[model samples]
Structures are given as C-alpha cells and as structure tokens.
Target: MKLRKINKQVWLTEVELDGYNVRGAVICGDKKVVVLDTLSHPRDMETLSTLIQGRALIIVYTHADWDHIWGTGGLIWEDARIIAHTACLERFNTDVPVTLHEKQLVEPARWNGVQLVPPNETFQDEFCLDLGSLTLRFYHLPGHTQDSIVVFLEQYGILFMGDTVETPFPCLEKQSPLFRWITRLQRWESDPGVKTVIPAHGDMGGRKIIQRNIAYLQDLSAGKDPGVFEPMTQFYRETHGANLGFALNASKSDAFKLDASKKNNP
Candidate 1:
C-alpha cells in the first residue's frame, strides 16, 4: 500500500487490494479515526485493519459496488460502525444479487461464500459525521448508483468520490437519474473546497479532472461520438500505461464506446 497525506487530517492509501487498485481514506479525529472505504478482498481488509492497529475504525461505503464494499466484513469490529447512503441499503438488498453473481463468477474466491450485506445505518440527502474536530460530510451523489454517496472531508478539502468522476466521462448506464449525475458533477467542479478528489479507481488529483469529466459527459449527452472511450483513456494509458492494463482491456469499455457511437450516429 502507498500512502499520501492530502491534508492536515486526511490520508490516502493506494492499496493493490484484490484484483483492483482500491483507495481508502483515514480521517484522524481528536478522539478516533474514520475510514472512508474498505478494500476488495478479505485478505486486504485484514492487512488494512492490522496496519491501523489501535485506531477506532469507522467504515463508510461510498457506494454498493463489490470492489468498494466486499471487504466490509473483514474491516468491521464488534463495535465498529458501518454507514452508507439510504439508497445503498436498497441496492444491497435488491439489485446487488446480479452484481454479486457477476463478481462471483469472475472471481469466485473473493466473495467469501456469502451474500451482500446491507449497511447497518443509512442516511438521505446529506449527513454530517462529527469526528470531534472535523466533519465528514456525506452527499448522496446518485449518478453512479441510486445509493451512491460522496464523502467530503470539509476541513481537509478532500472529496472521496467512489466512481463518480475518475475519468473525463465515466460510464453511467448503472446510474439512476443520468441527468442528475451530470448536474452533481458540474456542482463539484465549481466548488473550490473540493481541492483534491480521491477516486475509488484512480490517482488522487485536483478539480481540473472534474472539468474534464464534465466535458466528456456533455459530449456524450450532445450526441457527439467519443470514439473508443474518452480522450482521458488515451492520456491515462500513456501516463500510466504499464499499470493501467485494466482500463485497456475492460470488457464494459468497448460496450460504452459502442453505445457512444450508436448515440452519435443515430
């Protein structure tokens, strides 16, 4: 795992967790510690928990995706609190069977031979978790999923976006209200407090990446072809080509590109 301090109390950990490069956040408060997302595999979560040793762990699921929440079972203690957006609970109970089955077939060993577990606590619209000195704000940003939430460490100026805007145009067929997703992306882009965006699948970066995402989504909505994925994919491949084999060979990516072509040529 690679660690970087983004702000005073916020820390980013880039872990080669399972089959994905998962990023988790640690917010150290006056009395305790808060974790943003867990890893993808039980082994990774065990490693993370062991590393955090004495600190109190508060795990918040940014969304209901398997990569983000599958390791929750490993991270939770007897007394730890697990929270997520209200919609996420619904997703966990209803739609996640398909997601889990897909993941199970693709990588059977990681699912732990169990079903998806709904989060214990859920909130709507916005919720503020008072971590003594810092407030971790959870915003229900539903484009990624109806239950998708973005964690904003207000004092730290870091937005832990779970598949919200990693690329110029993130595929949104899985989102509930596509237009609303676009709206939230624009709002985040304009917010100066959102100094650093730590995405679930990419490197932590600045607001300019948000702008690039907006442009790509806009291009998609305007019936303009984005060819095979967005321009950012090419940049990502060139910049981190050696480490980005997943992006280059993603099955859904070609489908996304085909969807763009159909929309543009329609």
Candidate 2:
C-alpha cells in the first residue's frame, strides 16, 4: 500500500489486490478521521488504522463491492460507525457472500481473515457528515451499482467517485438507467464547487473526467460506438462491451414495451 497526501487533511492510499489497482482515501478532520473505502484485505487497513490513531473514526463504504468493503473487518476502531447507502446494506447481505466465496477460491490465504461487516448506519438519496473542519457529502450514484455513491468534500471541492466514473470508459450495471447516470454527470459538470474527481480504479482528474463519462454514456445511448474515443485495456474493453450490450438490451426492451402498448391501444 502506498499513501500519497492529497492535501494537508486528505490522503490517498493505493493498493494492488487481485490484479486490480484500488484506491481508498483518508480525510483527517478537526473532530473526526474519515476512512473511505477500505482496500481488499484486512492487512491493508492495519497501516491506515495506525495513521488515523487517537481521533474519532468513521468508516464510509462507497459501495458494497467486495474490494471496497472487505477491509471493514480489519478496522481497529471497533466502535466506529460504518456508513453506507441503504441499498448497499442490502447488497452486502445478499451479494457479498457469493463474491467473497468466488474470490477466496482464487487466493484463500489473502482472504483468510476477512469477515463480512455491513454498515451500521444506512441512508437513502443523500447524507452528510460534519467532520468539524470539513463536511463529507454522500450522493447516491446508482449506475455502477444499485448502491454506488460518490463522496464530495465540500470545503476542498474534491469528489471521490466510487466506480461511478472511470477512465477510458465507465462500466454499467445491467439494469442501470442511462438517463439517470447522464443527469448526474450533467449536474456534476455544472457544479462549480467541484475541483477534483477521484475514481476508485483510475487516475484522478478534474471536471473533464465527468464530461468524458457523460460523453461515453451519451454515445452508448445513441448507438454510436465509443471505442473510437479512447484505447481501452483488455479488461476495460470487455467492460465497455458489456456496458454497450446492456444499453442495447435496454433499448430493445423499451421498444418492445412501446410496440406492445401501441398494439393494445389500437
């Protein structure tokens, strides 16, 4: 794990686990230390605990994906409140075990100490945490997953977009509403307070990253191939294809419903 300071109060920790480069953030506020998505393993979070010692701790899970939440078990602060979207709690309870089982099969030793920990506090739509020096705002952005959220540090204008936006291309949930994702992107674009955007799996950038994701989603909706805009890694190529497939399938489903409606009305 490598820790890089984003600012005096904020830090980014990068970890390579199971072939994926995942990042989590730490925001040291006046009254509380906020730990963003925990990395893949319990051992990864041990150093994090040491760094934020002696302050009130709040663990925020951006989503319930195994990579982000697995380290919840490893946190040293037992009394810390775990926060997430209500949908994230549902996903953690229903889908996380299957994901854990599949990943453990690949590397049992690394996951040996992992314990499933669900959020103790849950909310829908939006929530805010006043950390004395800065406020952390959680916005539910559901395109990546039903429970995916983006964290905005109001004072610093930094946004931690958990897999909601990515470099090259953004992945889509099978049932994600493209329009809703586009609307969120548009809102971000117009928000003058946003200075930086941090994605879970890609390099951090400014508002341009939000524009790029919006363009990709718009292209997918328009039936225009988005591969021409950027070169994708093998993994991202597969991801883009799957996203495109989901969009096409959704379009067809909508068309079919329209046709059925017309026939019934006539």
Which number leads on TM-score? Answer: 2
Q: Evaluate all candidate structures by whole-model CA lDDT and list the values in order.
A: 0.67, 0.83
lDDT of 1 by residue, 1-266 (tens): 56667666776766774334778777788766777776565544565654456777777888887777766666655577778988787886676778788777987876645435567788988988988888888888765566778888877688888878775345453312434556787788899989888788765689888787667556555545444444455544443332133233322355445544544232
- Runs in model 2 deviating more than 4 A are 228-231, 254-266
Steric clash count of candidate 2? 0
RMSD of 2: 4.3
Give Cα distance to truth, residue 39, candidate 1, Å. 2.3
In model 1, the runs with Cα more than 4 Å from the true position are 17-20, 113-115, 174-176, 227-266
- Each model's TM-score, in the order given? 0.77, 0.92
lDDT per residue for candidate 2 within 119-215, as digits (tens), equals 8899999999999879899998877788989999978999999888888678886676676767777888889999999998977899999999989
